[model samples]
Target: MEETTMLSLLPPALALLMIIATRKVLPSLGVGIIVGALILNDWAFIPSVSLIWEAFSSIFVSEGAINDWELFIILFLLILGIMASLISFSGGSRAFGDWALQRVKTRVGSQLITLIFGILVFIDDYFNSLTVGQVSRPLTDRHNVSRAKLAYIVDSAAAPICVLAPLSSWGAYIITIIDDILSDYSGIAYSGLQAFIYMLPMNFYALAAILFVFLVIVWKLDIGSMRKHEERAIVHQQLLDPTRKNVPGDHSQDLDTHHGSVSDLVIPIVALIISTISFMIFTGARAVDNATLLTIFAETDVARSLVYGGLIGLGASVLLTLSKRPSPFQMLRATWNGIKSMLPAIYILILAWIIVTIIDQLRTGEYLAGLIDGSIPTVFLPALLFIMAGLIAFSTGTSWGTFTILLPIAGEIASVLDLSMILPFLAAVLAGSILGDHCSPISDTTILSSTGAGSHHIDHVVTQLPYAILTAIGAFIGFLVLGMTGSTLGGLLVTLLIIVGIAFSLKSVITPLPEN
Candidate 1:
């Protein structure tokens, strides 16, 4: 492998800064890709152009064949968009909203329901975000909950919940990585599953993030940008900010939504959830002999499974829409409108993927990971590793990639320093990757969370930042305590107290937007 220096950091850093400044994601990602390409080609114009083209093309074709993973993900997104449109046209979303309105009487209840749905869909983060958004949007909107807050709830529940659930796709992937890392050290007695279970308590960020979502909703602790969004929703009945021109996954204007029942929405979503889980099991089972549930998930093709499940869900949605006896023109319009709504998300996703590829070529993650050394104090290792992993994931816009790169380094470091500290170091990396993923504007999960909630992507990113940062502060403190005391319980208790204190303090001083 080629050695990468600090130069690798320029593209993502510039991209992040530009996104914050301009609030324009596409141009920001484009500039980042160009800068990375130029750096790789040493500022040679023609070579850089060629590199950029190659990077873009690689998304569709890799190794002279179709890139199944990327294409499948795109297909699933389109399918989901179409399904959402069909559901709206069939009146299912409206019906479900009315039904929920009768039972969920308060804004808090609606938000809590959204949070509960997020927690239940732990199979995959992508699935969780979109599915939860689809189910919870109508209820939240009816209760005047802002799309930004819904997106925050969806995003918070995604990576954090998936990381903790052993039966989830995230869990399987992490377990595999942990197993590989463990292979290098001979004296370790526990298996990957055992290590993962042991480290669960040590993953302070994920735990804190999940708790933060619940507490924020129950306590009405809206602060910063989130407060502005909530105030608009409550006072003006505007679920979306007026300035947000492009709200992804919004099909309101495109569909009639006046003629169907609750079954129209519930049936398709149920099919999607069941079929996706079935496909995950099926695909995973085919890859391994003597497959246990754990092995099956570990070997599952997540992208492919999503595509398969999406097809089934789309089919169900089409049938439900047809049952409504809409005009042919209405059906076509709904389909087209759904696809159009997702186009923005698709465009952003492709550009994000391209930049991530370019960053990979520059070895940006490796460059970031290489910064860690033995000079760091043993007691500070967990907190430092958490910070380092967060930076790398933030720069790369990929938590799984961060895990792949940093986990081995963490293992090597622990082996040399203190073997018993392996779980803490590994747990810190898990926690930090999630924290960065939540904060990074370019992260796919973050993008999908916005799409799912039908919020302007930048709006979701901005409103969610303070909440993620607050949780991160708590996690950082927890990791510091864990490192010094080596007690997960002590760290967790301190983290909980700190989070509660900060949340209450913010709620007291940050005057909420008053009802008009």
Candidate 2:
């Protein structure tokens, strides 16, 4: 019954995914949910069409099963939409472009700054990618650099850096999971949360990803199809007049107006940064309360950040409106448009929440977890964990889902093997999941990063996959060496040195495209 139920859910979900891949959003999602519902409810026959109505009715009329996490994600998307809109309209994005461009004259410079931002924001991948992509796009394009590369830079660094940062959101979650696995295992005396700070220095994948981005940028490594695209952008730029493209510099997405100058942008962004820090401090304080509060805090902080983000955005929009410089009304309209645009992502998240809930409730998670733990040999565990994580993220298009599904399994498997190894395995899984999400076009953060860059999401995905895969392979090898040698920090440093050596070797080959 268990296998049959899990297997039965696959076709409808897959059929729905096919539609999503084809870019049919609404119908695809409706069908996807129907498939899950039918399989779970065990109706005599699949209700392909009627199930849609039933879903709607249940979602609207019956509130019991509505997952709060889904709602939280929806609210997160809406807040992001509003935030992006405000940034654009209020000139925060423009100022960032101007200021960033001033410092990043070369491709190497842009890549470095992007890597730095990724390192700094080491919290939420969504926030990191969106922030870095939007702020850096103008500068990268100005350098005749490809948008796809910029997406690669942001996506590659976002989650990896976050997982490594002890104070950031990703770090916190990574620690919590580690803590759980350790608490249960006899030999593993330390908690996941406590050890992350220590193990962070030893995380090979995170170190390798950062180094890879720098190498790809400085060396301008043209792997796979990206080489061709680079040539095309260069040839195309050389033919056109430099002044012809942005003559009046129409930066506004809505109209033909020129993008504002640096001052126009910098202040609000600073405000946002300041505001975020302030909110973080407040939340951190509130989080330290009793266990019950901690649980609520865990459930709500990610969403609370969104709420704070949205509120900050609203305030920034108001100020921009008052400035009368770009026309505040336009900002308001754009913000609304932004929120509307986020609707699809919101729905997809809700469905993800539902599916995760189903998986948990069915107790199928334990059986699957057992199978996974028992099947893999002890020696191959870390490598297998990373590969499995990447596949799950690639298929589901969400790293969080991969984390939710994989962490426990990896933890249990670690218990089944040597409990002391849980941290390494879990870290590998997290890193691999992040790699897949960053590179996969279907992944929401990747999509949003492209959206932030004003590039076709598919183009970004195509361009990034090579670099992402290369780094992942490097990380995998590094993990294998560490597991075999039982050497912490040794593999990561070696990987970094290897990446740097490759970067220098490739440096002479890539010339900048003729200035646009």
Candidate 3:
């Protein structure tokens, strides 16, 4: 391991290939991390083992991966699942579905509306995915839209939009990380928080996601595995023609479920949202001076929201039981059942975070950071670096891991170049990570969103990639022009125009039919 730059990075790349080829995430991450650690330590057997151990240690060791944000996220998912089960038991979701059907008259309308619903839940990516998927799944199923496609739509919108939204918790985190960079550079006016609020309109990924959802609905253009499922569904219908084939009455999985009042659904969701806001305020997130003292409540938004939602559902169940007068033991059984049902989601979260931990400890990310800094050599390289960062994130299957490793490196590189471009590069890394997370099949959010939508995993992955790649290409062109011109806002404007051009081109390809 007497290192030459290019030669040293080969093992980690091979390991990533191993994971992706097998369609397995955790073991792949483990192998990649172990290989990376070994290389970083020059294959000095004991040190190499120690490096890998450090990676694994974070999962169980003090101040390790489990103790960080991953733990809160897993807990949040568990509580949300519990809340969802309770809502189902209480007939809230069903009631809301019935109300939606009454409002929507056609499949196309429902699909478009479901996309709208995805945009509506904008607080956090995790919250957005879980809420939108659960709410929209029933309607999409009714319309013969594959659950896999729905998952793609939900996942596409969730993280892409969350990072872009100024009002979200993501904005807060990004601002904290890059505050120093913004302050150091006079040209980049507006503080970190204020800049994001304005940049909301400029976020290429977020805009692309929202537009793509609408395009899919309006164009009715099917591609990738989604098209295959759609074709299968169509063929199944045609074969069952009354004149030519014996079509069994409804053999495909039925979307039927109990319908109830909107109050049942609306109450729990509203409670969750309001509770999140209150918790953030209570946690002193708005008060920097008290941030240390408020650390106790800082990460409680997810926990508080889920706990409130669960309790609210329990209260509703109580009211329903009291009106119908069920036995106490029966009620207890139902409540326990609700909690038990979330076990699968809990397991998925834990495994996903562990995989992320493995990827992070590999030290391979540092090599890429070094590579970007070395190769770029000038301010013009940030855009290309951004695209590369996205690719790394996608290949690795973890956005948090990508950001954690890349941000510091990008900052140091910017400092060396004196380009005053750290924030924008950080933005690129953030955006790149989002793009990768959006596209990567192994990404937890992608899988979770698919599961929540009741969609086939591979189907979702294939269908979504085209649109994300299109946006990425458009963003790259815009960023390229930015590197040459040396202007962030100017680059953003150009990117928006490129997106508009794509939208127009898409509109032309998908023309509407005239009435008979």
Best by lDDT: 1
Rank by TM-score, descending? 1, 2, 3
Candidate 3, 1-516: lDDT as tens digits: 443455444554654466447644446555655655666676777997775566545544455234544555555555555455545555565667677777876667767877777777766676677667767755665555656567777887788877876556565566555665566655666676675565454355556566666766677655655565555544552211132211111112212133446675566666666665566555545445546422323233654454455455445545643444446765555555544544544444444554455444444455566656465646466576667678767756777777777776666677667545555666677777888888876577776676566544445666678878877877777667666776767777777677667767866775432110
Expressed as tens digits, the lDDT of each residue in 1-516 for candidate 1 is: 256988899999999999989999999999999999999988898999998899888889998999998888888989999999999988999989999999999899998989898999999999998889988998998999999999999999999999999999899999999998998898999999999999998889999999888889887888878888898899889999887676789987755556778898999999999999999999999999999988999999999999999899999999988987888999999998889989999999999999999999999999889889898888999999999999999999999999999999999999999988999999999999999999999899999999999988988998999888999999999999999999999998888888888888877887655433
Which residue pairs collide in model 2, if any?
Answer: 178-192, 179-192, 321-328
lDDT of 3 at 410: 68
Off by over 4 Å in 3: 1-72, 183-190, 197-202, 232-259, 285-344, 373-379, 415-424, 442-444, 456-458, 487-490, 493-516
Taking the tens digit of each residue's C-alpha lDDT, what string does model 2 give over 1-516? 355334543633563355547644435545555555556566535453455455444433456665443354456556656655655665556566667777767667866777787777765666676666656665665666666566677777777787777666666666666677667767665656567766775566667878878767666687665665566555664211232221111134533143555644455455555665556556666766654422332433664564576467557655654565556566667766667656544554445434434434343333333345476567677777777777666655667767788887887777767776777777778777777676654466776565555444445666777777767777777777667776667667666776666566666665644433
Q: Using Cα atoms with residue i matched to residue i, what is each candidate's TM-score against the true structure?
A: 0.98, 0.79, 0.77
Candidate 2's C-alpha runs over 4 A off are: 4-100, 228-252, 256-261, 290-300, 325-376, 440-442, 497-516
Candidate 2, run of 10 with poorest lDDT: 240-249
Residue clash pairs of candidate 3: 58-65, 95-260, 147-455, 148-455
